[model samples]
Target: MTRQALVPTTHERGITTLTLDSPANRNALSVSLVEELGRALERYGKDPSVRAVVLTHTGNTFCAGADLKAPAGPYAFVALLRQIAELPKPVLGRVDGHARAGGLGLLGVCDMAFATLSSDFAFSEVRIGVAPALISLPLLPRLDPRAASRYFLTGEVFAGTRAQEIGLLTEAAPDVDVALAPVLEALRRASPQGLAEAKRLLTAGMRDAFDRDAEDLVQRSAALFASAEAREGVTAHLERRDPAWLQ
Candidate 1:
């Protein structure tokens, strides 16, 4: 069997769209997927013709978090997130599906995110006996504190409207494309230098958060993933049963 590219790139009118194409596992961040995405971003970041990049996905789920079967190293994942956050050009998000755990990290760091009203989101790490530590690098700075606390602790699912209200989405509408059109048009019109400088100004706080807490959070995340509780939770999830903690 031939393997398909995990992150596929398409260029249109100065905009580059990078699709997360591994639907079989709900586009989980596997080692290969992260590497491919990181490399693609690097290439696009240096391409003068590419004005901006759109991070999107294919499948009912945009991303279902990490691929436990072949998860990327925490440091590698953190580096990928940093790459996206610090990309000189604007990175937009277009989502029409569910995003959970680390998936929301992708959305959080995007300069702008647009999703269909039907799209859902969750901070599911707690239910899996882990924490949303690494993802907080981008998310904590952007998310509403009260909402973050509620969703992070409860692992509750929220729809796009609520996601927007909580500062996790730039806009959520009946049609994601409709919401994204104007933003895309603006990007297409702006000079690359203007876009890059504007993004730098906007993302300064997020970058600071990354520099300040990334290592400590990465260590915490690695420890949690290695713990017996996380093993039980992951095992129970794969087995389609409740973890011992739930019982």
Candidate 2:
């Protein structure tokens, strides 16, 4: 609980890898971790020599979503996701394990995501009586509408291959680095100005749109999480039982 939440490593190849390091909580997006991640990315944004960012995790879970016990507002997280999406350089998500809820939103913001074939994902907010409102900013843009609707409502787990099928990941390979290497190399080959401009072309105005809508979405998330039903759902989940509505 009192250690570094994110670890940054730079390689000679102009890649900076940010590992979600709080494995004790399965890399939950606590306030401190989220803040640290934002800071790292912001620093990377200012470096012209950094060609790409690799977002990976250190444990069996890529990310288990937000730490429910961490009493913080969604504003920071909303801003963090926006920052990643708008970073001039490409961000590659390398998922070797499971990710849930807010974690899957991170994948949605990636320029490309490479995942191990066995990884799993879910938009699990609805199950906890909260809407995936803030996550929807990035997620809705990339996800197949039908798939998003089904998974968002049902909170069912899906395989990495299925995630790729629905556009959450660019590739689902048996080996994570193997699939990611060529992509990184390709990014490396591109001129920094070219990558930044091309990224602008690919994502023009999306950041502005997120900025415009984020406050309302965060408010919705906060209201739902603070609701009576959400309290019941959280209790039932922790107790390993169905909520009263389900029973």
Query: Judged by TM-score, which candidate is best?
Result: 1
Off by over 4 Å in 2: none
- Report the C-alpha lDDT of model 2 over 1-247, residue by residue, as the tens digit: 7754466565658888998888877888888888888889999988988999999988899888888777346998888888988899998888999999989888888888889999999988888788888889888888899999999999999999999999899999999999988888888899999999888877765686696898889889888988999998888877888888874
Residue 23 local lDDT, model 1: 94
lDDT of 1 at 137: 89
TM-score to true structure, per model: 0.98, 0.95
lDDT for position 148 in model 1: 94
**Alpha carbon lDDT of each predicted model:** 0.92, 0.86
Least lDDT summed over 10 consecutive residues: which range in candidate 1? Answer: 178-187
Candidate 2 lDDT at 50 equals 95
Model 1: which residue pairs collide?
Answer: none
> What lDDT score goes with residue 71 in model 2?
35
